[model samples]
Each structure stands twice: as structure tokens, then as C-alpha cells.
Target: MLNPPIPLNEMDRLLSLSDLDLDYAAHQDSFKDLTKLAAKVAGTEMSLVNLIDSYTQWTISTHNLELEQMPREDSVCQYVLMGDGSFEVEDLSADERFKDKFYVTGGPELRYYYGIPLNVNEHNIGALCVVDKTKAKELNPEKIELLKIIAGEIVNRLKYIKVIEELKSNLSEAKQTQKKVAHDIRGPLSGIIGLAQLISAQGEDNQMDEILEFMSLIHKSGRSILDLADEILSADNKKDKKTPELKGNEFNLLVFKDKLDKLYTPQALNKQIKFTVNTSLASETIPFSKNKLLQIAGNLISNAIKFTPVGGHVIVDLNLITIDEVQHVLQMRVTDSGVGLDEKGIATILGGTASSTNGTGGENGYGFGLVLVKHLIDSLKGTLNITSIPGAGATFEVNLPQ
Candidate 1:
């Protein structure tokens, strides 16, 4: 026999629901009680909660039935799903559609079949059914109504399971976010505390000019820590409230360059690493989110400084390139002469596996920075490419539409 045709929209909805993947047969105890109640209420000897897939009809819960699954072609529930109301066959042997079916003509000789479709997510994917061996009389109005009520209960349980699963997934993601925040702030906080201690040790014994310089370094380190905290808190708040659409704001390239220089030049000098920034559009202003851009650039530069060995170099280049001769793309590239990544390390970092590694300067990192950078780039509708050769260097290129 041919398979029954399913409506396109119904099929789409069935595929989207998480309940379809649930192995209801494995946890059949609750449903087994439901089937028993259904049978007792409807005055039937056998009851089943049947789920129909592409080619099989699975009995998730059954009372007085031996089989767990049968071919979908032999299923009465398939016909039940064709209607919004219950399907009732008072005498299966007298019905033309089921008379020749093996279950009717062969063993058990089912004579009565009644099924109410179970609707979930506005789609009927299964049925609550009752069957009997002896010819049975037509169901009364009260019994039919009770069957429908039980089917509705099954649908509610499916929805409840879906909600619980979603909550669990969200909680897991939130915990990971907290871990990432702690990881990203560690290096900057260490710098702040270390610089503050240096300023305290130099009290009164240092020359006035030297004292002023050390105090400036301490202030800069403290601001870096604050900026990192602010970025994390802002991201969490947006997520908690459901992220709103971002709007473009005026971005000054020269101001951005100055911030980058102030932020990393001292750290580079301390480590004896060459740090340079080259921008072709220094005086130009662009429409972009300045804070988001700063977050991405800051994380990249910080990671580069941490990984690059002494005597190595880190370079940042910003320019505009024409694409298809009709649009300009803003290109920002960060290149570093660091201990470059192997394939395994690259996969672990970019895939958000939270792998931690010690940097060239013994700086500890949890690998969340690159994951955040990738997410930010995607939100901007941009592309990021990383090129690396082990023991040589690594380069990260980002392109955003302008």
C-alpha cells in the first residue's frame, strides 16, 4: 500500500519540534498509565499511544498489546491523522478500507478501532487509540470526549519537556559566559595589581618625574581592567534582555589609534616587543559601533602581545579596499610574530572549546578572547581569516562592509 500524503506545512512543523526525536517508548511508564486510564474511561480492552514516523508506527504506550512497532502502511492511526476529530470504526471487518488488512483478517482479528489524534505544536504527529477483538458498539458522546481530553494531556506533556530542555541549554550557556568573563579579565587585572604595587614601593625614594611616570602606568592598567569588565557586563546585560538591533555611530580613526597606542605600547616596551599601528584613513570618520570595534581590536592586540616572544613584533594595519568596484570594505589586519598555532590548537580555540595555554611571557589565557572576537565579527556581518605557520607567525584579517 502507498503511504498517506502529509500536508507540507504540517510536515515542516513536525520536523521542527524537539518532541519528534524523543524516544517515548523508553519512558513509557507515565504514558502507560495514560493508556490504562484511556482504556478504562472509553470502555475498551486495549489502548495505545501511537507515534507515526515515515515508515513505522511505534506504540509508545500500550495496554494489552504484544507488538511495539508495525509497518505504517498497516496503521489505523495514519487515517486518524487525516482529520481533526476522532476516527471510529465500529466493525473493522465491515469497513472496506481495513477489511483486507492482515491485522483484521489474520491473528487477533481486531473488530473495533478508535483513535483521537494528538496535536503538538499545532501539528498531529501521533494518536491516542483503542482497539478490540470482539465487535464493539459505537462509542457514546461522553467516552469520546474523555478520549480527546487524554490526548490533550499527552500534548501538554510534550510541550513541557521541550521547555525544560530549552531552560537547561540556556543555563549551560550562561555558566560558560561567566567562565569566559573571569578568564578574559585575569591578565589585565594582574597588570593593574602589579603596577599598583610598584607605585607603592617607589614612595618618597623615587625622583618626582619617575614617580609621575609610574603613577601614569598604574592608572592606564587600572583603566584597562575597567574597560574589560565593562565590556563583559554590557554583553551579559544585552543577552539577558534579548539583544536589540545595533545602530551605527560615528567612529574616529585617529582617536582609535591613540587608544591602541596608549593601551599596548607600554606592555610591548616592557616585553621588548615591537608594536606598530599603520592606518591609511587616520583623519576619516566612519559609521560604526566604536565600542564594539574597540573590543575586537583590544582583544586581538592583547592576545598578540601575550603570545609574541621578546624581540618579536606585532603590527596593526587599517585600510579601505574596493569590492566589485561598487562598494568599499573596511579591512583591519593584526599580524604577530608569535608562537604560531598548530591545526589542533587552531581548532580548539576557534571552535570555542575553552582550551587554556600559557603565553610566551607566562601569561595564562582561557582561549575565550578569540571566540568573542569571532562572535563580534559575525555580528558585524564581517569575515575573519587567520593564517599561521608554526614557529613563524600568525595573521588575523577582518573585513567589514562599508
Candidate 2:
């Protein structure tokens, strides 16, 4: 005979609780102990906790039995879900409903059976059952009550597992977010420190105008750092918050170049590497987030300088390209003659694997810089392309709508 059909309403609830599709068999020790306790309390030789889905019956916990699963059509627990409470079969071989069943006639020769439905969120999903080969008397009232209580405990344990899994997932996400924030902030903070030190060592003969300009740049870098920190904190607190409005400031190309020059010139000079910048943009001002743009540019340029040999060259090119005779796009390209990336390295880095290595100058790198740059470009709705040849160089091209 075919198995009894599950009610549509209960099936819907079972589908909704998909997160409870756990492999309880992998954690057999605790569940085996529960099954043992259950068998002793109910005075049964064989007891098991079985989770019944639409297609199969999975035995999560079992005592005095080696059975693990069976087809739902052959499951004895199917009858248990048909009622509001515990179900019992005093003699399966004599019962007309199961006398011809394979489990009764050929498998386990099951005769006496008793089961309590395991319900979760009003859905009858499984059962805690006990079976025996020999015909046994009907369960006493006290044994039936004990089986019901054990079933409730099993349901509670499943709920607890679900909660613990969610907490672990959240904690993993929090750690990744923290790592990203730290990686992004490091570039700008280094720039601020370097620029401040340059301003301090200029001595008494330093020109007043140059001193003021340096100080202004320092202030801007400090504010940018604070803004980044605030944004990260806000994201953590309000996960469902809508994306904030883009804060656009008038970005001057000359000022942008000056900042890059201050940040990378010393490093390039110390390595005796040639550094060059070429621009073809006619516009002086653009509306964009200065700090975010700086981070993208600074990170790429720093990586170029760090990896380039003493005689190698690093180049930055900027241009404004008109698209479809209407929209204008800013194209920035950074090319470096350094220890380039092979296909595997490029895939690992772009895939956010967080791989790290030392540069040519023995300068350490966290390997998260390119990952952060890619994330920033995505936020700006920009496109980035990478071209590289091992032992030759790598080129990064970025295009953003104006």
C-alpha cells in the first residue's frame, strides 16, 4: 500500500522550515544518548528519532538498532502523523493496514510499534518511535507520556541548533567586515603620517605658502579618515539601512595630483624608480567622493612603487572620454614595470582570498588592497580591467561616469 499523503497545509509549513534540514546523523553521540534514555524510559528494546520529509524517513538517533533510513512509503511513522497524539500498533503482523508491509514480513519483522509525532512550528515533521520484533502489550499510560516528553525535548534541541548556526554565520560576517575596514583605512592613515612628517622637517627656511598647503592637505586626509570610520560604524549598526546619498565634493585635478605626488614620490625616489603622470582632461573640477577616489589611486600607485625594481618605471594616465556624444567618463590607468601577476595569482587576489607577500623592497603587504579597490569601484558604479604579464608588469584601468 502507498503511504498516506501529507496534508497540504502541514507540507507548506515544513517547506518554510528549510533551515532545519540538518544532518543530525553526523552528531550521533548526543542523539544516541537521547535515544538510549528514551528507550529505557519507555521500556522498549529499540527506539529511534526519525525525521520524515516528503520523500524519505531519516533516522537521526537510534538505540539497539543499526537502521538509518527508509522510504517514506514504507515508514511506520506515516500513521503517527495522521492523528493529534501518540500512535500505537500492538501487533503489526495482525493489523490489516501493515500485515503485508515489507518491514513487517521481510525487514526487521517489526510487530509491536509505538510513536509520538515531533512537531515544530505547528508542523508535524517527524516522530520519536520504538519498535520490537516480538508482539508486545500496548504501552501503559506512563510510557506513552514519557515518549511524548522525549519528543518535545528533541524538537527543542533542533531549535537550539538552528539558533547556534545563525550566530556562527553572523560572527563570521562581522570578522570579515572588520578586516575590510582595517585594510581600507591603512592607506590614507599612512599618507597622513607621511605628509605630516614632511611638513615638520622643512625647517625655518620653508616657504609660508608651501607650509600652509601641506597643512591643508593634512587636514583633508584626517577628515577623510574620520568619515570612513563613521561610515563603517553606521553600516554595522543598521544592516537594513538604505545606501546613503553620495557625498560629492568639487574635486580639483591639480589638488588630486599633489596628494598623489606627496604620498608616493618619497617611496619611488628611495627605490630609485622612475614615476610619471600624464593627463588629458580639460575640466578642472569633477563631482566625486575625494577620499574614496584617493584610496583607489593611492593603493594602486603604492603597490606599483613597492613592487617595481630600482630601474623600473611606474606611470599614471588620466583622460576624459565622451561616450555616445552625451555622457562623459573619466578614465584612469596605472601601469607598472614590476614583478607582475600570473593567471593563478590574479585569480586568487581578485577572488578576495586575502593572500599576502613581501614586495621587492622587503615591504610587507596585506594583499587586501586590490580587493578593497575592486569594492570601491563597484560602489562608484565603475569598471576596472587588469592586464598583466609575469616578470614584465601589470596595468589597471578604471572608468567612472562623470
| Residue range 323-386, candidate 2, lDDT tens digits | 7544777778999999998989877656645455667866544454576567667767888887
Per-candidate TM equals: 0.46, 0.50
> What lDDT score is found at residue 360 in candidate 2?
81
lDDT of every model, 2 decimals: 0.71, 0.70
Cα RMSD to the true fold for all candidates? 23.6, 23.8
Error of 2 at 330 (Å): 34
Give residue 184's lDDT in candidate 2 (0 to 100). 79
lDDT accuracy of residue 387 in candidate 2: 88
Q: Best TM-score goes to which candidate? A: 2
**lDDT (C-alpha) at residue 31 in model 2:** 72
**What is candidate 2's local distance difference test score?**
0.70
